[model samples]
Target chain A: MTINAEDLHKVAHLARLSIEPEATERYTQALSSILSLVDEMQAVPTDGVQPMAHPMDATQRLRIDEVTETNQRETLQRLAPATEKGLYLVPRVVE
Target chain B: MQWEAVIGLEVHVQLATQSKIFSGSSIAFGAEPNTQANVIDLGMPGVLPVLNEKAVEMAIKFGLAVHAEIPERSVFERKNYFYPDLPKGYQTSQMAEPIVGLGYLDIPLEDGGIKRVRIHHAHLEEDAGKSLHEDFHGMTGVDLNRAGTPLLEIVSEPDMNSAREAVAYLKAIHAIVTYLGISDGNMAEGSLRCDANVSVRPKGQEKLGTRCEIKNVNSFRFVEKAINHEIQRQIELIEDGGRVIQQTRLYDPDLDETRAMRSKEEANDYRYFPCPDLLPVELDEAYIQHLKETLPELPEQKRQRFTEQLGLSAYDAGVLSSSRALAEYFDRVVELSGDAKLAANWVTGELSAQLNREGIEIEQAPVAPEQLAGLLKRLQDDTINGKAAKQVFAALWAGEGHTADEIIEAKGLKQVTDTGAIEAVIDEVLAANPAQVEQYRAAEPEKRGKMVGFFVGQVMKASKGTANPQAVNQLLAKKLEG
Candidate 1:
């Protein structure tokens, strides 16, 4: 559960975030604090306590397996920033 | 030396929610890069995370589908990471208290055996934005469109033995998710993805070997290939007296090999902690019971019913029940055709084959269930022969929505059931082919089949399949014998 400031800095760089150099120490402290809180769960003695995955015991509320949504080109296109003739245009994908 | 490959899958399915898991952003696909991204999705300051009730419902639906336990209280944990696509620099997911747990899915094996894959847990989480590396050159561009999309991380126990079981398990998860209307489960759209924790030990070994996690395997074929490649690599290392390192790896599908992404033993990138921004979501027992009541017949139950009630073969039942769309389609066909076995046959056989060939789905099929039933009824009633029905089926599949009777009537495809018309044609054929008839009488009796066949063809040409095949054969035989 121990994390180093240098490790935090490295992971930040690898993830391509523009983390300020001064923020690394702060992040290192905050992450350790959170992990320590997670560590507190070990003391709860989950020997017989079951791990939970969902909030309900219901199994598979399935649909009739049909496509309900279809042919909404105009509605979907409204969200696009740049579109021409039903094609989304980004900043020149190919040079 | 018998070596068993023990495999397990950790599949991540994006839940079908109207909004982002922790935000109100629209959960729409193929939208512009940042249009759907909201303040919470963008990880903007002071934007508190709000759990989408629909996402929770979907997780409950999935839990119920697998017969898993749903916890009354679950906490969202911040998986601390720095990824450009992860706008918050930490993913909000269930870590300690997941939503579902201790489930098992019974998968029917190819060899008439059954394997029960123990479900570890399925937790709800938010999706990260996409990295558009392919679109951008040199540097990867981030699209926050998918950020905050709800996802359910379904982890399975290491009970799988081979690549086949793993694929089956993945497919089962896919069907469950799609059936529950949880997510489209489209891997190509990144709605469904799999990360595998693969390891190798000698066959029947008690100790689990050093494991490596393979990330973001999108396709089922890739999951099998990546696991096989990784398994071979691990086995080779163990054989050579080398230790398999615990780390995260990436499957280079182009090279068909797995390369190390990071050393997990050294640094687990995820430093998980309960998120203070979101409180524990507690569901009451009554609500949970109501959800249970609403769950439809699961894939296994439907498959069993198709086999027992519909009298379909296990294979056909499995195919039909594989997806909600397919099963419903089959049911509609049966309702229309009023023949369960025949409906199962046409839906699984001809309809499925056509859909696969066109890379479409049952929902997208041009031929409606009523149209298919109508066509089959035509064949049943001798209004059109089987050969002519195929042509009608093809035309109907190509957007021609004419009824079977109408198509047969329009194309003059009716089977010739009239004996008088067929007899006239048979007489003309016998008169025109006296040489062949004489030769047939003079030659061996076997040669008579050829003469009769010629007469039958002439009758068919004259009557244009309107002549009943039984009638044609009977009339030809009587004349030839005389």
Candidate 2:
């Protein structure tokens, strides 16, 4: 029901965000208040109301399988920081 | 400690669709790195992904084959993660409502029995790109050619208890996908990939033990080895007064050991949510029936027909029916040649060996099924002996002649079935090899039976390998005895 600084830190780490030590208390307090608002909404829910997955409830439209895109590497690679041998280079990751 | 391992496999079969699952870019492998990535797959802003109809149909096809429930409504969810290969921070996958549900596969066991492995579900998703580490000089090179390719991740219940059973289950999955023509099921090019969940408990324990996931074991042999090694590691950890840590482990094939992947250990929280851009896919009974009509006879059906109707052994039936291409080729050969036994022998024997030696699939072989059936007919009618048939087959593969009769005529490989002509050659061999004849005659009774091999060899050589070996053996036995 309440968010602590440790939980805030874990969530920040999962989102790949580095939060300053001084700002943890502020973020934790803000998250806890938002949860209390959700708690209030949960308390006021009607007993027989059905949960809706989507508002329209329309099915998705599918496209037939075909290759429609052409090579845009020259235009796209210009936006990257580095490239070599037609490959985009990044920080080394081993799996 | 008498530990028993509980294992399950997660297989990702790349659907053989022409384009990306959600984009129009080509999913073709081995292209220039960034050539295949379009704006949408590259995670540009405000771009929505549209589902591919063929991929959805493929998912339904697989569900029908396994007798799984094809849900009227299936939804795709976004699994949030951070990886350099994944340009989008989250992967679009199916979590709660997968397309295929509650399937079962009957795997053939080593003892000639069938074991049913329960399937949890299978879902359709897009694949990530590849990271090349070797040539990047401390920076990873990313090839997005494989990105957005359609993959069906089939999850199984914890039904198998050993590596052998797990492999069997994986093989059954491979057979079905390849049979359905939905996937190529090639492991070397990463078409079919697998991850394993393994745990160990005391023999009579009712509750399950904690499990470790062995991730991305790509090959069949490696799947067996990885599961076995993980089982051993877990058992040893429990016996050594240590509790097994639930984490992901990587199997090192060179060392034959599994070690915890520290990076992936703490990163297990995949907060999944539905993608608002894509609506739930709804399929009606009419669409499901259409796909069901397009389905071919599956591997189990073909295997049963081969053994029961064609009078083949279970092993031969299984081998012939493992792939659609192989089974279709065998069927055509049998239809043309009118001899199922001979067709089975050649297709599984010489044709398979040649295909294996050339490192090609049966569909890509140099000789066609009709051509092979023609060559087989020659052998059936004693037009060419078995040895001559091999020569004819080799010639056919070399493109020397189009049909078996043409090659047999050109190469003079026809069998010497004429009794008078064969007798003339046998008489000549007996006259020229007077010393061997005296030795064969003076030998003891049992020794003489073995000694007749020399005269048969001489007659076959004297006839330039065109003599029927069986006729030569019979004549040699009679002539040597007299």
Candidate 3:
């Protein structure tokens, strides 16, 4: 589960984060320590126990299906880095 | 030397819920960009997602319709990816335990046989928003109105061996969702879409070949063509001594070919983990039972009823029961006319023809079911012959009259069943064509049967197509013989 520098750069790229070259080694070590902690949990044996998704074992609270949203495009689009024709604009995405 | 294509479909059905799956934002289509997006949909800080109960109900209905296992507990996980359309850096989806468990759908094939496509599972997820590339001056425009829309992604086992079976399976899913009232199942509106995983292996090989997925095929025809194109591409690649690479491909419907979008090596590893913001969905026995009881008669059950109880052919039953609206229309017609076969014929034949011609759906038909049944009733009672019934139908379709009797009466198209009146028309037709009559009398008996149709036509023409054809045939036979 430990991430090396090369894999960390790839992960950072996938996350669309640009990490400085000096910070790559620091990130790799920090992420690998987190993985080591998760690895410690993996070593514990609880074969029959179900995997826990939430700490409190609470069921999902349901909401009735209703349209409570109002038009806020003008307000939201203003927060974007760029916008045109009421849409949030970004660099061209081909696929 | 023969290659067989193995196809599996992953269909994303937008649940017909009013709001987004986890947010209270509207899921209505055709909204202005980002108008329907609320704070939660926009991935603002401190916003939490609460699952929509209606969406869960819809997923349960689909699971039950396909005879799938509905687990009491399902967890929502974060599928992490980076796309501008996904304002949330990750999508909320079911990864480990989906709401719907294993199930199988028995799709009726074109050759009157059924093929059972095993379901791998179905998971509930929120949809990503749209990215408008056109008219953006080389930049991309993002619309978040579709973001966080509820979706039920149904995945199938690789059981379909041909394009035809894949299309049938897709169609069956379409019909089921539409019948369940869970989704509109409109491909044009993208309420229903499919991604096909295709591979080719040598015939009788136990191991499957490398699979490539064709993404976001919107229509059933395109699904078929895309799969065929992908299969051919794989087969050709293998035949040329090149191994097929696993990749995600896009089907260019305009080009009718599939091109690689990205290789599998570059595919995103959606680091999935349970979302701590949303709790696990736990269903009680009572809730599941209530959903089961409220379920409507599914397509297969209705098709069976039409065939066994109503004495309809399998094909006719399939056609009539394909959609709930159509089946209801047929049922109303049958109830009014008390003739299942006639109702089946008219519903599938003339009504369908006219609807196709006018480019309208059955729900938008100009003629109502009762009016059509009224026309069929006249034909049954000899108030109007078939030809006159057709004329009445045309008039009804044109909105000339509201009732079949009104149209028939206005056009004077009632069948001439009176013995005396028909006898006069027959006599006049015989006298008007004496030379033909003499020729008929002098002809052989076998020839007389053929010649009798000419007289019947002449008599019908004289009667303005209102004469009962069977009665005209019998009377014409006796008179021409004498």
Off by over 4 Å in 2: A40-51, A91-95, B1-3, B134-139, B202-206, B235-243, B263-266
RMSD of each: 7.1, 2.6, 1.8
Task: Please list all clashing residue pairs in model 2, or write none if there are none.
Answer: none
In candidate 3 chain B, what residue range of length 10 has the lowest lDDT sum?
A: B262-271
Task: Tell me the tens digit of each residue's lDDT in model 1 across B93-147.
Answer: 8888898978989876666456799999999888887656453434456667788
Clash count for candidate 3 is 0
lDDT of 3 by residue, B356-460 (tens): 998999999999999999899998988988888888999999999999999988999988888789999999999999999999989987777788878989999
How many clashing residue pairs appear in each of the predictions shown?
Answer: 20, 0, 0
TM-score of each: 0.79, 0.92, 0.96
Error of 2 at B294 (Å): 0.6
Judged by DockQ cut-offs, the docking class of candidate 3 is high
CAPRI-style grade of the A/B interface in model 1: incorrect
Question: Cα lDDT of model 3 overall?
Answer: 0.91
